[model samples]
Target: MPKLKVLNLFRIQLSLLPSSLGHLINLQTLCLDYSKIEDFAIIGKLKRLKVLSLQHSDIKELTTEISQLTQLRLLDLSNCGRLEVIAPNVISKLSQLEDLYVQLCPIQWNVEVLEELKGLSKLTRLELDIKDSKMLPQGFFSKELRRYNISIGDWPARINGDESLRTLQFKVNSTISLEEFQGIKNVEFLLFANVENGLDELQSNITPLFNEKV
Candidate 1:
């Protein structure tokens, strides 16, 4: 398996990878989505890895060594409700990160939780479970990130409608009026979650009703 560069264990029984997996020096993509893996520390040795998808796994914590993969571009942790922690500055360490998806993360719920994202200057897409909209630091959304998904617990005063945004998902837990989305436009995919408004009323506020997603 010296030439093996891609590994896709969609649903394997192997919960933990052997430390010798580091020998895959040329490996570039690793897909471990929907596995029972509880730990993810050995894969960091893949210096050439560019894509890693660990969506919907039992992984509760990531080792500090995860930040060592500076070449990583995409990391999907969606539906990982049990994921509890990421080493401080772990996100910031992935200098080449472009698409970062973190949904329902049960880790620290504070203002600084989003602070690590600011350092990923190359980010192009971001999905976050925003528990406290007020805690969001200034410029939490980068103009460079064309795709965004944010679940807000509280109504935010200002939401950036970047002209470059290709997809925007505004998941509000509060019963806010849909009229607030009148400013959003020209997005390929737009989603509204948990809005306590009727379909007719919700459509009246948003101009492009045809582009609604979920």
Candidate 2:
């Protein structure tokens, strides 16, 4: 079992990982999706781990220990409603990470957390949700990202778009200037929800196929 490369403990009704799991030095993929296990400290021992999925799990926080998996390429924390904290510099430590999914999670996003994402030089795909559109900093996302689904408000955003295109959706509650955001310049699909009168003010060279004004 020391040479195990994949472990699918998905939906397992366990509280903790077995101590022997640390012996799987060669493990590359571990899926705990929809599981009740919360303690992930043992996962840090898997130096070769490349993929980790905690979707719909009961984990409350992403502790510093998990950042030891420097080889991680894909991490899925989507639908982790209980997830609250992600230790500082933990995300930047995943130097090899290429894809990250945090959609539908209840974690509070701040400027510090958003800034940390910029350090992932290898990231190409991302799915994220920010509760307030005003919190977005100028030049938010990296220009190198090929595909993304980002929702910046409480409204339900349109998800239909070309898979090759980057999508950015946000709710406009007050008068605001969109041109200041350099990250939106490359966005192929954009949604401006609840914009009342000034649709022309937000227009740019990039025209969005979806725009809902009320």
**Candidate 2: lDDT over CA atoms?**
0.80
Query: What's model 1's lDDT at 89?
Result: 65
Clashing pairs in 2: none
RMSD of each: 6.9, 4.2
> Against the correct fold, how does model 2 do in TM-score?
0.85
TM-score of 1: 0.72
Tens digits of lDDT, candidate 1, 1-214: 8778899988766778878788989899999988988878897789899999998888888667888999999999987768877767677789999999886676655557578787788997877766554565655543445677655553343244454556565654333334334334445555665545566655555545354431
> After aligning candidate 2 to the native by TM-score, how far in Å is the CA of 180 from where it should be?
4.0
lDDT for each residue of candidate 2 in 44-86, tens digit (9 for 90 to 100): 9999999999999999999898889999999999999899778
Off by more than 4 A, model 1: 154-214
Model 1 scores what on Cα lDDT?
Answer: 0.71
Among residues 3 or more apart in sequence or in different chains, the pairs in candidate 1 whose N, CA or C atoms overlap within 3 Å are none
Top TM-score: which candidate number?
A: 2
Give the least accurate 10-residue stretch of model 1, judged by summed lDDT.
173-182
Best by lDDT: 2
